[model samples]
Target: MAHRHDDLAGHDPDADWSLPGWLYTDPEFFEVECARIIRPSWQIVCHESDVAAPGAWRTLAYLGENIVVLRGEDGVVRAFHNVCRHRAMRLVDGDSGCARKLVCPYHAWAYELDGRLTGVPMRRDYPALALEDNGLVPVEVEIWRGFVFVRLEDDGGPSVARMMAPYDHEIAPYRFEDMRRLSDVRCRERQVNWKNVGDNYSDNLHIPVAHDGLTRLFGKSYAIEAAGWVDRMSGQLVDRASDDPWERFYQRHLPPVPHLPAENQRLWLYYKLWPNMAFDIYADQIDFMQWLPLSPTTCLLREMTFALPDERREMKLVRYANWRINRTVNAEDTWLIERVQQGMASSSYAAGPIGRSEVCLRSFAAKVRDRIPEARLHRAPPPGWSRRVRAI
Candidate 1:
């Protein structure tokens, strides 16, 4: 591919065309993205609190690669490609656990929490095998605030902290490290391109028309702001309470989160991190979502919610109400994006102009172009293009 920003400079934001529809449904393009974009990007693995103690470990699959993040005996959190050195077999199976040593189920090769190959089942048979040279390969790991992120590629871009520095103060008040995850990671499969899901998340223009419940709650105050590679969409809850019994009851009875300011008590904030992560903050809770692509036209919306533990009866009820409300919002988003995906597959549909509120979408698409230059094509790439660009 051409150098970064080479193909993207020609894009005129005010009068530019959206990405060609076929890009959403092309297998070749998806393969390119897997190689050039997703593999090299930093992905949220889990909260720091998830692997809080030595021996605590978490496992996940990213872009078809299995990854393991664990807390070592020295109290350092480390990540590794979840492949046993002995036979290229999987090292970890489930989501998380607390284990002193990771024992490969295939051959019983045990590795220490720090990824050192401690025991080879048949030590005498392989006398030439050097223990010093054989160990689980490490993945780059970083912790920002409370979230843990791992870079799969050895030579990826800047650290997550540097990329996120601009919003440090804004995110500090949440004390993400102090908050605990409220549930297990929940995922829902949707029939839409991952980029389409990202485009939908970055778009504030559709809030009024597509998200009726949100419109009723926040009115027309939704606004989008950009800083570096991050975008924030914010709106204040309408002062006039809703007529719906659940909404009214929660607003009237549930107390605002004590740590947040009076103004923030009624704010809805969504921060879009480039590529595929979003942190959505509400008055009383925080939700992180990852748009993990399963194929060209399918994705898994992996989501998790977090908050300071509360024992109040009314607050529990309010949290349940909030959960119900988010379900409605997500359902609305699913319906809208799936329809858009269906339209993209149709022969009659073509690229459309973006509105002002969708400037973030344009910027995101530009980032995609920077990573995969051939995204402008309305059909599959030339036979050699993917291999050629991937070599770069």
Candidate 2:
């Protein structure tokens, strides 16, 4: 019997590169995503280093729900719903800080670092209420390689280890344990949809035309290949052929570090998880971007962290240079996505064909439609499910 992947050989290369128009503009679809995708999937809350010491805490917004991540006196980090049990007042107001106890600003209902209700402003008023039962609701929190992830679903879908199993080997070399957060920049209230941002970053087929600065620095013939679950794109500097100049420059002013790749000097890897997270790894630093949907057309593209402690000064300088390169590239892509959104809103527009190079994007859309079966109610399962079930 032929394997499932073998069947992909006959898949049409001219197939449409578009998703349903309603996916980007429908309010009901966004609500369904919040329930099925955002809430159930593992989410990055903050880095473990951010809440290292006892009482250190950070507040984050998840699917419109306020969440607080805190390190207890025992040095264990945990996540809790930020709302107070009594009157639902927010316990922690600011971004992050060390606090001995989380005291509600409204009613002074205090909670311990472990999320236990330790004090009430007026215990005499509500004698019938049980403090033990009314403690802050705890969310599942896990720390993997210094990054903290939280899951809000009651079922506890998958462990962080399993969710990130795809890129474990690629990330091992980064030494995430030794890294520290250097900067964070958030783009809020953006008019583009969240999927638009994700679809922009998922593939680099347009990089040569979209990012002229980058294309000029690292030649336009950059190669893109997929390995396991991650996709890599790389390009080499044409001018840096001989090692004599680089060695001389390194000897004079820079510390020892490997020179760029011979064929592809600058290797820029962009990895996208199944749902909505992206990891953009450059030579010196890594960018963790999470695209969160606030509404159908408005979303938050948060730059959660830029971390690199190995070559702080050099990385900082190069980071800004790459940031400028990325800004230009993102602007071009976002413009196209916004245009697509507008076209989607138009009554005349319909689905269009995806190019041969856009297989990844097509695969991504298929996977999305597969996982959220409700989205593809018309299609039957592709052979594997029934065969595997019968084999079992």
Best lDDT goes to which candidate?
1
lDDT by residue (217-308, candidate 2, tens digit) is 55654655433333444554444332333322322332223433432224556666646777776655677878888898878877755555
Which parts of model 1 have CA positions greater than 4 angstroms off? 1-15, 154-156, 378-384, 388-392
Scored by TM-score, the top model is: 1
Candidate 1 per-residue lDDT, tens place, 1-392, comes to 00111123354442266787878887888887877788888899899899999999988796889899999999899999999988899988889989889999998988998889989978889978888788999998989888899988844566778767777787777778898999999978889999999988978778878887777777777778656677788877776788766666656766767887777887888988878899998767899999988999999988899988888888788888888877888889888999999999988766777554466776777777667667765555567777786598
- The Cα error of candidate 1 at residue 236, in Å, is 0.7
lDDT of 1: 0.81
TM-score of each: 0.93, 0.82
Candidate 1's TM-score reads: 0.93
Residue 302 shift from truth in candidate 2, angstroms: 0.5
lDDT score of residue 65 within candidate 1 = 92
The 0-to-1 C-alpha lDDT of every candidate, in the order given, reads 0.81, 0.67
